[model samples]
Target: MHELTTVTDSAAAQLQQVRDLVALLDDAQYVRRPPGASSVAGHVRHCVDHYAALLAGAERGTVDYDRRERGGALETDRTLALARLDVVRSRVRALAPGVLDRPVEVSGIVDARGTVARSRSTVGRELLFVAHHAVHHLALMMPVVRTLGVSVPADLGYAPATMAFLRQRDGGTPA
Candidate 1:
């Protein structure tokens, strides 16, 4: 059997990147721009909340993350969201190696048809998914950042070889 090691360290590093990005964003960037779109910061807050749920489920052995009904709490304020982000990061980092040996229980609508689904996977896989999810959204956010004349980190995974070629073509240092 291929033993799966906990990706807690890499997750921690990604969380640090998220925190850095959050620090760099101002109120205008954090708030919603489009009438129907979620704010960029709101998406990060949602990702942190997902991490909190995953951590809780890992500890308790079960959780229903797909439940859309309010779980008896008001919407968290930005300060509270940041606090929860810190706590979730600490929890993931502190988890024992063996903790990820088992699969993670997750429930949610896997599609747009409003059908709810349940599944399980190793904690390491789940963390990898979460990291990639953040990367996916972060890329979508690049245009928004560029519109503000801010340069994003090139190492945010744009195929290093391609980036190097583009930089060389553009007469700049290869990233």
Candidate 2:
């Protein structure tokens, strides 16, 4: 098992990257859903929904990722999206240290047919999942941002494990 603090810290860093990305974009860019791509605000809202589900479920011992607030201001309004970004980050960081060890029942839509998969997990594990979920969405958003002529962090979309490997292979430098 991994140390919960380490997992949370890395997750926080990932979210911070997202915050930085949003700060760099203009109002139009933030809400622009590029052709065949999701908008930056869309990704932020989706991530917040997962984080919200995790936070809500942590208290009850069951997390339903399928419970999402799809579309609306969160996906269109930059101000709302930015506020949610901060709130989710604060909520994530404020999670009780011991809560990570608590058991949680998890559920999510798994297929095109809308099948739901169920499983047992710990809050620490769910935190990792939700954070990585955001990172993957960030991956999709990065290319869209790039095509719009905006600069972004080189390591924006990489998984924590991949980032560690990159630093190691590159002699402690981000490459």
- Candidate 2 Cα outliers beyond 4 Å, as residue runs: 172-175
* lDDT of candidate model 1 versus the reference: 0.61
Q: lDDT per residue, candidate 1, 1-175, as tens digits?
A: 3244436776766666666655566656655344545555666665676666667777766544554333222133445545656777788788777887767677777778978777777667777666656556655655555565556676653433455688788855535
Which residue pairs in candidate 2 collide? none
- Tell me the spans in candidate 1 whose CA falls farther than 4 Å from its real position: 1-6, 34-37, 68-79, 111-113, 157-175
| Model 2 lDDT per residue over 45-145, tens place | 88888988999999999999888789878877777777877888888888777989999999888999999999999999999998899889888888889
The CA lDDT at 13 in model 1 is 64
Candidate 2, poorest ten consecutive residues by summed lDDT: 166-175
- Candidate lDDT values, in order: 0.61, 0.85
TM-score of each: 0.71, 0.91
User: Which has the greatest lDDT?
Assistant: 2
